[model samples]
Target: MEELILTIVKPLVDYPEDVKILVNEDEGRITYQLSVHKEDMGKVIGKQGRVAKSIRTVVYAAAGSTQQKKVFLEIID
Candidate 1:
C-alpha cells in the first residue's frame, strides 16, 4: 500500500525524498496519511482538490473489496 502511494505521488512532487506515508489500521478502517514537501502540496492537491480526489479514487479502487476494512487516504503537510 505504501509502495502504491509512493509510486503515485513521487512523480508529482518536486521533493520526492520528502514524501512519506503513515498507516493507521483499526477494527473497521485503514487510513493512509500522506505527507509531502510543503512546496509540493499544491501540486499533489491540484486545483479545487481535483487531483487529490482522483488520487484517493485510484487508491480506494486499488484497495478493492476483498478487504474487510474501509480504506482512506489523507493528504497532509
Candidate 2:
C-alpha cells in the first residue's frame, strides 16, 4: 500500500525524493499519510481536488477485495 501511493505520487512531484508515505494500521483500518514537497502539493491535489478524489477512488477500489479493512488517505503538506 505504501509503495502504491509512492508510485502514484512520485511522478507528480518536482522532488520525488521528498515524497513520503506513512502507513498506520489499527482496528482493521489502514490510514495512509502522504507528504510531498510543498511545491508539489497542487500537482498531487489537482484543481478543485479532482486529483485527490481520483487517488482516493483508486485506493478504495484496490482495497475492495479486503472488505474487512477500511482505507483512508491523507495528503499532507
Candidate 3:
C-alpha cells in the first residue's frame, strides 16, 4: 500500500528524492505515514484536501484487496 501511494505521489512533489513512506500493521488495520520535503507538502495535499482524500482512498482499496484489512494514510510532517 505504501508503495502504491509513494509511486503515485513521488512524481507529483517537488522533492521526489525526499519522499518517504512508513507502514505499520496492527491486528486488523494498517496505517501509512508519508513524509515529503516541506516544500512539497502543499502540492501533495491539494485544494481542500482533495489530493489527500484521493491518496487515502487508494491506500484503502489496496489494503482491502491484498490483505482484507482496513488501511489508512497519515500524511505526516
Output the number of the lDDT-best candidate.
1
Measured by TM-score, how close is model 1 to the native structure?
A: 0.95
Model 1, 1-77: lDDT tens per residue?
78989999999999999999999999999999999999999999999999999999889988875567899999987
lDDT of 3 by residue, 1-77 (tens): 66788789988997899999888989887778899999999989999999988888877876777876677788899
Residue lDDT tens for model 2, 1-77: 77778888888889999998888899989899999999899999999999999999988888877658899999987
Ten-residue region with minimum lDDT total, candidate 3: 61-70
Stretches of candidate 3 exceeding 4 Å from the true structure: none
Q: Per-residue lDDT for 36 in model 3?
A: 93
Question: For each candidate, C-alpha RMSD in Å?
Answer: 0.9, 1.2, 1.1
User: Model 2 misses residue 54 by how many Å?
Assistant: 0.7
* C-alpha lDDT (0 to 100) for residue 60 of candidate 2: 84
Clashing pairs in 1: none
